[model samples]
Target: MTFEMILVIIVITLMLAGLFFEMARPDLLVFFTLFFFIMTDIVSTDEALVGFSNEGMLTVGLLFIVAGAFERSGLVERLVSSMLAKANTRQGAMFRLLVPISGFSDFLNNTPIVVTLTPIVRKWASENNISPFKFLLPLSYAAILGGTITLMGTSTNLVIHGLLLDFGEKGFNFFELAWVGVPITFIGLVYLIVVGHRFLPDHKSLIEKVREKNTKDYLSEIQPWNRQRFFSERCD
Candidate 1:
């Protein structure tokens, strides 16, 4: 094999080994791999750093900030409480969860959608005596399905658009992916509500199981604000 091929193999091997052994974070592993390639002249410094300045990467970063702000504003919380509080059955709950998530994810990044919804869904399930398993997998699936509904819905689509630009080809429009994505999302939702529930296990949450086994609470106090805040003085 050629020297470049051998180097590629070694880098890939090290990456996999680091992942399997839990030696470092995945992003750190990728950075190290890129650094190695640049140092060895397999990839130029410009090539190694170009992705940081890519429009797609910048868009993804902006989307993350917007998502964080939206989540913090309590709009999702209010929406969840107002809509989902009335769902009595598991099917109804699943429907409520899927519809809003699928809708929001079409406009926003799905990662933050899932992250914001996970604990809320868990708490809702626990309170309503519904199995978390019934809702958690559907939450992830709905986010993924929703992301396809718009061109800017997921980072993957933007990255592919960037790749197309790099290749001197025109990329997709905002609603380009909506045609197929809408139909798929509709079909997937129907399947999840009608047939998918049967396949999901009605398992209790870990906390519930632990509580049942031992009627003792393990409490740890944590203070969130360690640093002096400008907000407190402003409010005063």
Candidate 2:
């Protein structure tokens, strides 16, 4: 093999190893990898840095900011609260959670969609006595499915469109992928409701586990450190 090919293999191997070992953040690792490729002359400086100026990247960043604003406004919370009122069973809860998440993720970036929904889903599950494991993986999968529904759904689609533009090719139209996306999402959600539900774990969530431990180790009063006279008892 050529020296360049061998070096590429080594770099790829190291990146995989780093990721598998959880050595660092994935974004940090990717940045360093790109830097290394630049230094090795595998790609021109412009090519290596083009992503920084890519419209897709900027759009992804902006979408994340918008998602953050939407989150802070508590609109999503209100919507979730109203929808969750119908989630009385595990299957019902999963359906209620995944359907809306899928719909939003189809039009918005999946990363922010998942981020915005995760805590809400967790809280809803905890309050309803549902196992978090039953819905967390499904939530992730639904976001991915939703992203496939539209060009704007995920960064990868936009990134590919940007790359096509660089090559003097026409980019995909918005909703071009929806033809396939709609069916896939429909079938996937059906499978999750029917077959996947049987496989979801029933384990207690971490918060529930911690609460149980606290209850078991209950210590209402400490003998020596008691401050009942000064703190608890108040003068009339």
lDDT for residue 192 in candidate 2, whole number 0-100: 83
Clashing pairs in 2: none
TM-score of each: 0.85, 0.85
TM-score of 2: 0.85
lDDT digits (tens) for residues 3-74 of candidate 2 = 999998999899989999999999899889888999989978989877788877888999999999989999
Pairs of colliding residues, candidate 1: none
Model 1: per-residue lDDT, tens digit, 1-236? Answer: 99899989989998999989999999899888988899889999988888987777788788888877877998777888778878887788778879888998898878778888888888877877678898888888898889998977888998898889888999989889999999999999888887888899999998778767977667999778734575777778
Candidate lDDT scores, in order, read: 0.85, 0.86
Best by lDDT: 2
Worst 10 residues of 2 by lDDT: 227-236
Global Cα RMSD, each model? 8.1, 6.7
